[model samples]
Target: MGTVLITGMGRGIGRELARVLLRRGDRVIGTVRDERSISGEWSEFLASGQLRMLVLDVRDETAIRKAAAQVDEPIDVLVNNAGIIGPQRQSTLDMDFEGFLETLNINTLGPLRITHAFLPHLRRAKAGKIVTISSRMGSLSYAKADRIAYRASKAAVNKVMQGLAEDLRPEGIVAISVHPGWVRTDMGGTGADISVAESAAGLATLIDRVACEDSGGFFDWQGDRLPF
Candidate 1:
């Protein structure tokens, strides 16, 4: 019934989010970096109806614009789920500079680029919702990290969405940042506490129930507001 766009649908939360949305009868346009090479549960989702994949690399501004162009159905919801964990287990002081730059490009700049391309569409919808998939590791208040690149990139995303919410309130489009919990995905690792479906589903409910006043805040999958 509603048209929703999600990025990084190839796996993890993005893939589960697409499945959940489609099962609810929403038209889900999911973004992937490759059209030909697909695998795992994601390929199964692609084979089914209610979900469609478009080759999209969020680091490419032109690709994001092209993705927005294909979203003819006045996008009601936009989820910036595309992100990278980068080279793992590197501390901030010992972090590789090149890896940090790559992480920032995919996780931080990617969301900003996509939001910019789709803001006009969201504004036209007038009462749209934009949820940026962030992490608790992003929080400066809770920041204690081994993966510096991932944490820092998500922190940057948090700030970007926070600023966007202030500017977009007048347009009636709500933008909220979410930490999907420590989900048991590739990024979250095997020791994580929550499952991907659990995180994605809970976030969906939170997004649905989000008040205008909730804009510019960061929250966990349980809908608890996190410190800035």
Candidate 2:
């Protein structure tokens, strides 16, 4: 199994994804904003070296760089999963400007910062893949006005991932944006359609099968191509 680094593994889809990868023997390097986020169940994995935890917020570039400096081995996959649902008062007319800016910083810029910091580890691997958790709400094709800030951030990140894929194509490093679907998580809410298991399972499978040829593409958790 390969080494995979996942951001925001404290809970939700990120946490579930880490569980799935770990059970299958993949080495998981999970990041959380606090040490308290580490589950006691992971003690065995931590002892065995199958799991490594990094405490840092995605918005902190310096912390990310410091964490990246501590890792000397190759990283086969980097999953940018840390994100926020954005402010409750998000709308075109009635917007929370500060919250919107924070959303953009964490959701859009955070992934890019982490990717840039850990690029060396990815380059050392045989094949590197960058997977950023994006949302279909971000699609320009959608005219929906709810959660405008979140939508805008996702759309921006999608464009960023596309450019990154193109730039890294010659190096054989793949980068893609994924819509994980509306699942029953803190961000997705309890009324959401799918379970975390379903979303995480689909994501793990999709990540495993993606190739350099699929770079710059947008896909869903089920591996279906999505419109940019």
Candidate 3:
């Protein structure tokens, strides 16, 4: 039973990942913007002692560091899953600048901040891991026409994960990014093909198998290699 820390755990893929990890007997430290945002059933998870909730906004680096310091148990894994879709689907010309910046703050830059906070803690563990829940939409090699802002932010996230994989290697810390498919969620939309449960389960399997040698690559939910 490993101790895993997950950000953006209020809902969607993050919440599902927490549930699956807890079911497998892993201790989960779930971070959200606020504790009140946690649902009733989640309280039961906390009560059961497999889950702990922390208040943290992805955009806030201060909170990430402070929370990391509060963690007494050693963390075996860190999952950076907090992200946001750009406000309204529009062409790049139509996208608001502030909205675009917010997307970067949450989707790309958030992982960097959280990972920085947890790095030392992870290094202390014998074998640590960091998984950034990335999107295939980020692939510069396979860029599509629309959703420019979201796509650009994810691309940035991909690079961040790659750099992290290199930086953490000497410490025996594995860092990799995951493509969870187009999951059905607030972010993925109803038209998406995969359910959050299905996607999270696949991602957990991928994360579980992330060895040190696999650190700087991108993989899909099914553990197949994804194009950069």
Which candidate comes out best when scored by TM-score? 2
Query: After aligning candidate 1 to the native by TM-score, how far in Å is the CA of 53 from where it should be?
Result: 2.0
lDDT of 3 at 69: 86
User: Tens digit of lDDT per residue, candidate 1, span 1-228?
Assistant: 677788888889988888788778787888889976445555555576556778889989998888778765677788999887887546866878888899999999998998898877777674788899999888998848678888889899999999989998887788999999989998889999989999989978886788789999998998999997
Regarding lDDT, does 2 or 3 come out ahead? 2
Using all chains and alpha carbons, the TM-scores for the candidates as numbered come to 0.92, 0.99, 0.96
Task: Please give the TM-score that candidate 1 achieves against the real structure.
Answer: 0.92
Residue 227, candidate 2: Cα error in Å is 0.6
Candidate 1: what lDDT? 0.84
lDDT of 2 by residue, 1-228 (tens): 999999999899999999999999999999999999799989999999999999899899899999999898999999999999999899899999999999999999999999999999999999999999999999998779999999999999999999999999999999999999999998899999899999999999999999999999999999999898
* TM-score of model 3 vs. true structure: 0.96
Candidate 1 stretches greater than 4 Å from native: 37-49
Task: Itemize residue pairs with steric clashes in candidate 1.
Answer: none
Q: Rate the local accuracy (lDDT) of all candidates.
A: 0.84, 0.96, 0.88
Quickly count the clashes in candidate 3.
Answer: 0
Clashing pairs in model 2?
none
